[model samples]
Target chain A: MFDWLFRYANPARFMGLSGALLPWLWSAALLTLATALYLGFSAPPDYQQGRTVLILFIHVPAAIMATNVYACMVVASLFSLINRHILADVAARTAAPLGAIFTLLALITGSLWGKPMWGTWWVWDGRLTSTLVQFFLYLGYIALWNAIEDETRAARICAVLALVGAVNIPIIKFSVDWWATLHQGESIMSGNLAGPFLVPFLVMMLFYMLLFVCLWLTRIRTLILERRLRSLMGAA
Target chain B: MNFDLSPYGAFIWPAYAVSALLLGGLTLWAMARWRAVKAKLATLEKT
Candidate 1:
C-alpha cells in the first residue's frame, strides 16, 4: 500500500522523483500565497477586534505550521530511529531550521498582535509559554545536531529528543482550555469565526503549509546532494 | 494593498512584515543551498 513511498525512500530514487515534483510544488505554493495575500485585504474586520483581526490572517497560520512542522519532524525522527537508511535522518535534520523559523514567526507575530489587544507584549499564559518552549525545543534540536560530529549517533540522540519534545505539542494546543489563557480558544474549526474572516484565514493556512512543504523538500534535496558530494570527495 | 488598516495598522503591519521577512529569508537560503550543492555534486560526478 505504501510501496510507492518506500520505493522512493532511496536517496537516488528520491532525487529522481522529487526533482520532477518540486517545480510544480514551488509554483503552486507561490501562486496560492499571492492569492491569499491579495484576498487578505478584503477579509472583514472584527467588530470587537476591528482591523486588528488582520493579524489573525498571518498569526494563526504561522502558529499552526509551527506545531505541525515540529510534528512532521517527529515523524521523520521516528523513521530515522527505526530505519537504517540515512534519508530519514536527512529529512529530520533538514527540517529543524525550517521548523525553528516557523516557530519564531509564530512568536513574533503573536507578540505583535498581543500588544494592541491584550495590552501587553506577552504574558505567562499557558499557550503562549508552551509555544515559546516549542521554539526553544526546535533551537535545542538544531544546536544538538550541529554539536555532534558523528552523523548516525547525532541522528539517534536527536530523534530521542524530538520524541521527548513531542509531549509539548498537545500542551500548546489545549493550553487555552486547560488554563485560563489570554490566547483565545480555537475558533477556526468551531464555526465561531465569521465567513469573511474564515475564508481568507483558511487560504492563508493553505499557503503557509504549501510554502513549508516546498522549502522542506528543497532543504532535504540539498542535504542529500551534500552527502553525495562528501562521498565523492572521500572516494577521490 | 489595503492601506486603510488604520487604528491598528501599527500592529498588523509589523506582524505581516515579520512573517514575510522570516519566511522569505528561509526560502532564499534553502534555494541557494540546493543550487550550490547540486552544482558541486554534478561537478564531482562528472570527474
Candidate 2:
C-alpha cells in the first residue's frame, strides 16, 4: 500500500493523477455547494438569532477549514524539513495563501454575524482574539515563505515557523472554554445545535471541505508543473 | 422569509454582496493564474 501510494509521490505521476481527479472534485464541490445554499437560505430563521444565524452556513466551515488547513501545512512543513521532500514543501507553500483566505473569510463573516447579534463590529473576546492570532500565523507563514529566495532554505525556515505556530491551534480551539467570552462554543460538538440547523450546517461543511480539497489539489499541481518547467529551462 | 429587510438590509446585503464578489474574484484569479502557468510550462516543454 505504501509503495503504491509513494509511486504518485513523483511529480509527473502526481500531476497525472490530480489532473484526472480535478474534474470529479470540482463537480462534487459545485453540486454540494448548490445543495448547501438551497438548504441554507430556505431554512427557517432560528427562534433566537433569526436570519443572522444563516451566516454560520458559510462562517463555521470557513472557520473550521482555516485552522485545519493550517494544521495540514504544519504537517507538510514537517515532512519537508525532516525528509527533505520537495513535494511536501510545495504542498505547504501552496496551502498557506488558501488557508489565509479562508481565515479572512471566517473573520469577516464572523464579524458580520456579530454586529447584529453581539451589537459590535469587533470584540477582543477569547475566541475572537485567538482566531485573530491564527490569522496572523497564516500571514506570517506566507510571509516567511516569500522572504527567502532559496527554495530549500525557505522551506526549512517556514517549516520551523509552522511548527512554532502550531501552538496557536489548540488555543484557538479551547479559548471559549478557557476564558469568559461573548463568542459561543461549539454548536455541533457540544450538542447545542438543533436538528433543524444541524443538517444544513453539516451539508455546508461537506461543501466547503470538498471545495478546499479541489483548490489544494489544483494549487499543488500548478506548483509541480512550475518547478518542472523551471528545471527544464535550466537544462536547456 | 417575510421579515422586514428595511432595518438591517443595508448591513446584511452588503455583507453577502462583498462575500460573493471576493469569493468569485478569487476563483477567477486562481483559475487564470493556473492557465497562465500551464501555458508557460507548455511552451518550455516544447523547447
Candidate 3:
C-alpha cells in the first residue's frame, strides 16, 4: 500500500516523479481555481449579509486551509520524528510559508468580512485571538528552523514545536462555541449553510487545497535540487 | 453575463485583492526560485 511512498523516498526518483506530475498539477490547479473564482463571484449574496457575503467564499477557504495545512505539518513532523525520514522534514519545512500566507489571508479577509458586520476591523475575541496565535506559531516554526545550524537538531526541535502548536488547532476551531464570541460557530458542517452557498464555497476550498499541493511539491523539488547542488559543490 | 456586487464591494474587492496579492506573489516567488535553482544546478552539472 505504502510501497509507492518508499519507492519515491529516494531523492532522485522523487525528483523524476514530481517532475512528471507538476505540470499537470499546475494546469489542474489553475483551471479549477478559475472555475471556483467564477462560481464564487456569481453566486448569490446572502440575504442578510448582502454582498459582504462574497468575502465568505475566500475567507472560509483560507481559514480552512490554514488549519488543514498546519495539521499536515504536524503529521509530517511526527513521521520525521519517529522514522527520521528526510523527506518528512522537507515536507514539514516547505509547508510553513504557505501555511503562514494562508493564515494571514484568513486574518485579513476575516477582518474585511467582520468590519461591516461587526463594526470593527479587529477584535480580541477567542476565535480571532486563537487564530492570531496560530499565525504566530507558523512564524515561530519557520524561525526555529532557520535559527538552528544543524538540520537534524532543527528538525527535532521544530517538530516538537509543531506538535505543541497542534493544541491550538482545536482551540481555533471551537473558540466560538467555547467563548460565544464574535465568530459564529462552524456552519459548513452543521447543515446550516444554504444550498447556493455550499457549492462555490466547496469549489473554492478545493482550489485553495490544490494551490497548496502545487507549491508544496515545487518547494520539495527545490530543496532536493539544493541539496544535490551543495553535495556537488562540496565534491568539486 | 452581468454580475452584480450588490454594494459592500469595498470590503469584498479588497479581500480578494489581498488574497490575490499574497497568493499570486507566493506562486510567482516559488516558480522563480525553482527556475533559478534549476538553472544553477544545470550549470554546475555541466562543468
Candidate 4:
C-alpha cells in the first residue's frame, strides 16, 4: 500500500493525477460554494447578533482553513527536508501563497465583524496576534524561497523556517482560551455548534475545503509545468 | 425587520464592499500568476 502510494510521488505521475482530479474538484467547489452562499444569505439572522452574524459564514471557514493549510505546509516541509523530495518542496511552496491569501481574508473579515461586535477595527488579543504572526511567517517563507536562486537551497531554508513557524499554530489555536481576546473561542467544535447554524457552517467548511483542493492541485500542476519548461530550455 | 439602518449601515456597507474588493483582488492576482506561468511554459515549448 505504501509503495503504491509512493509511486505516484513522481512529479510526472502527480501532475497527471492532479489534472484528472482538477475538473471534479473545481465543480464540487463551485457547487458547494453556491449552496453555502444561498444558505448563508437565506438563513434567519441570529436572535442576539442579528445580521452581523452573517459574516461568520465566510470568516469562520477562512480562518479555519488558513490554519489547517499552514499545518499542511509544515508537514510537507518536514518531508522535503528529511527525504529531499522535490514534490514536497513544491507542495510547500505553492501552498504558502494560497494559505496566506486565506489568512488575510480571515483577518480582514474578522476585523470587519469585530467593528460592529467589539466596536473596534483592531485589537492586540491572542487569536488576532497569533494569526497575524502566521501571516508574517507565510510572507517570510515565500521571501526566503524567492531570495535564494538555487532551488534546493531555497527549499532547505524554507523547510527550516516552516518548522520553526509550526510552533505558532498551537498558539493560534488556543489563543482565545489562553489570553484575553476580543475573538470568541471555538464555537463550532466545542458543542456550541447547535442546530440551524451548525448545518450551514459545515456546508461552508466543505465548500472551502473543496476550494482549497482545487486551488492546490492547479498551483502544483503549474509548478510542475514550469519546472519541465526550465529543464527543457537548459537542455536546448 | 423594523430596525434603524441609518447609523450602522455606513459601517456595514463598507465592510461588505472591502470584502468584495479583497476577494476580487486576490482572485485576479492568482489567475494572473497562473496565466503568466502558462505563457512562460508555452514560450519554452515553442523554442
Candidate 5:
C-alpha cells in the first residue's frame, strides 16, 4: 500500500493525477456548497437564535477546515521530514496561507454570530483563544517559510514549527469541554442540535473539506510549476 | 425567501456576505494563480 502510494511522490506523476482531478474536485465543491447554502437558508429559524443561526452553516465549516488544514500541513511536513520529499514540503508550505484565510473566516464569522447570540463580539474563552492562537500559528509558519532563503533550510525549520504548533490542534478541539466557556461545546456530536440544523451543518462541513482539498491541490500544482519555471530560468 | 430576519437580519446577512466574499475570492485567486503559473511555465519551456 505504501509503495503504491509513494509512486505519486514523483512531482510529474502527482501533477498529472491532480490535473485530471481538479475539474471534478472544483465542481463537487461548488455543488455541495451551493446545496448547503440553499438548505441552510431555507431551514426554519432557531427557537433561540432565529436566522442568526444560519451563520453556523458558514462559520462551523470554516472552523472545521481551519483546524483540519493545519493537521494536513502537519502530516505533509512530517512526510517531508521523514521521506525528504520536496513536494511534501511544498504542499505544507502552500497550505499555510489558505489555512490562515480559513481561520480568519472562522474568527470573523464567529464574531458576527456571537454578537447576536452571545451578546458579545469577542471572548477570551479557551476555545476562542486557542483558535485565535491557531490562526497566529499559521501566519508564523507562512512567515518563517517566506523569510528563509534556502529551500532545504526553510523546509526543515518549517516542518519543526509545524510539528510544534500541532499541539494546539487537540487543545482547540477539546478546549470547550476542558473549560467552561462562552463557546458551545460539541453540539453536533453530542446530539445537542436537532436534525434540521445538523443536516445542513454536515453538508457544509463536507463542502468545506472538499474545498480545502481542491485548493490544496491547486496550490501544490502551481508550486511545482513555479519550481520548474525557476529551474528553467536558471538553466537559461 | 422571507426578508424578515427581524432584529438579527443586519448581523446574519453581513455574516453570509463576508463568507461568500472570502470563499469566492479565494477560489478565484487560487485558480487564477494556477493558470498564471502554468502559462509562465509554458513560456519558459518554449524559450
Candidate 6:
C-alpha cells in the first residue's frame, strides 16, 4: 500500500500523477458545489435560523477544511522532517495560505451567521477564539517560511512549527464541547440536523474537500515548477 | 430560484457574497501564480 505512495516522492513522478488527476478533481469540485447549492437553496428555510441556515453550506465546509488542511500540512511536515524530503516541505509550504483563507472564510461566515443567530458579529468564546488562534497559526506558518532566506533551514524550522501547531487542531475540534460557548456543538454528526439540512451540508463538505485537494495539487505543482526554474537558473 | 429571502436576506446574501469573494479571490490568485510559474518554467526549458 505505502510502496506505491512512496514512489511518487520523486518530483517528476508526482507532477505527472497530479497533472493526470487535476481535471477529475476540478470536475468533482464543481459538480459537488453545484449539487450543494441546488440542495441548499431548494430546502425550506429553518424554523429557528430561517434563511440564515443557508450560511451553514459555506461556513461548515470552510471550518472543516480549515482544520483538515492543517492536519494535511502536519503530515507533510512530518515527512519533511523525518524523511528529509524537499517535496514534502513544498507540500506543507503551499498548503498554509490556502488553509488560512479557509479559516478566514469560516470566521467571516461564522460572524455573519452569529449576527443573526446570536445577535453579535463576534465573540471570544472558546470555539471562536480557538479557531482564531488556528488562523493565526496558519499565518505564522506562512510567515516563518518567508522570513528565512535559507530554504533548508526554513523547512526544518517550519516543520517544527507545524508539529507544535498540531496541538491547536484538536483544541479547535473539541472547543465547543469543552466549554460553554456561543458556538453550537457538532450538530451534523450528532444527528441533530434535519435530513433536508444534512444533505446539503454533507454535499458542501464534499465540495470543500475536493476544492482543497484541487487547490493543493495546483499549488504544489507551482512550487515544484518554481523550484525547477530556480535550479535551472543556478545551472545557467 | 427563489429570491424571497426576506428579512434574513441582508445577512445571508452578505455571508455567501463574502465567501464567494474570498474563495474566488484565492482561487484566482493561486491560478495566476501557477500560470506565472509554468510560463517561467517553459521559458527556462526552452533556453
Index of the highest-lDDT prediction:
6
Angstrom error of the Cα, residue A200, model 4: value is 1.6
Per residue, candidate 1 scores C-alpha lDDT tens digits across B1-47 of 57698889889888888888888888888888888988888887788
- Candidate 2's residue-wise lDDT over A129-232, tens digit each? 77788889888888878889999899999999898888656765586446644344543111134668888889989987887888888788877777777888
On DockQ, the leading prediction is: 6
Write one digit per residue (lDDT tens) for candidate 6, span A121-214: 8865665777888899999999889999989889989999999889656765576446644355543211134667998899999998998999
Give candidate 5 regions above 4 Å deviation. Answer: A168-192, B1-3
DockQ of the two-chain complex in candidate 1: 0.82
TM-scores vs. true structure, each candidate: 0.91, 0.89, 0.91, 0.85, 0.91, 0.91
For every model shown, the clashing-pair count is 0, 0, 0, 0, 0, 0
| Candidate 2 stretches greater than 4 Å from native | A1-4, A171-192, B1-7
Better of 2 and 3 by lDDT: 3
lDDT for B29 (candidate 6): 88
In terms of TM-score, how similar is model 1 to the real structure?
0.91
List ranges where model 6 is wrong by over 4 Å.
A168-192
Name the 10 consecutive residues with the lowest summed lDDT in model 5 chain B. Answer: B1-10
lDDT per residue as tens, model 1, A1-236: 65677899988899888889989988888888888888888766777777876787888888788888888989999988887568889899988888888888878888887888878888666657778888888999999999999998999999999998897667655764466434555432111346678888888899998898888888888888887788889989
The two-chain DockQ for each candidate, comma-separated, is 0.82, 0.43, 0.77, 0.33, 0.74, 0.83
Model 5 Cα lDDT, one tens digit per residue, A1-236 = 46886899899899999989988998998899888888887888887777777888888888878888988999999998998898888999988998999999999988888887767888656656777878989989989999999997899899999998887567655764466444555432111347688998888899989988998899888888888888888988
Which of the CAPRI classes, incorrect, acceptable, medium or high, describes model 4? acceptable
Lowest lDDT 10-mer window, candidate 5 chain A? A184-193
- Tens digit of per-residue lDDT, candidate 2, span B1-47: 34444455655666667666766676777788789889998777677
lDDT of each: 0.82, 0.78, 0.83, 0.76, 0.83, 0.85
Better of 3 and 4 by lDDT: 3
Q: Which stretches of candidate 1 lie over 4 Å from their true place?
A: A168-192
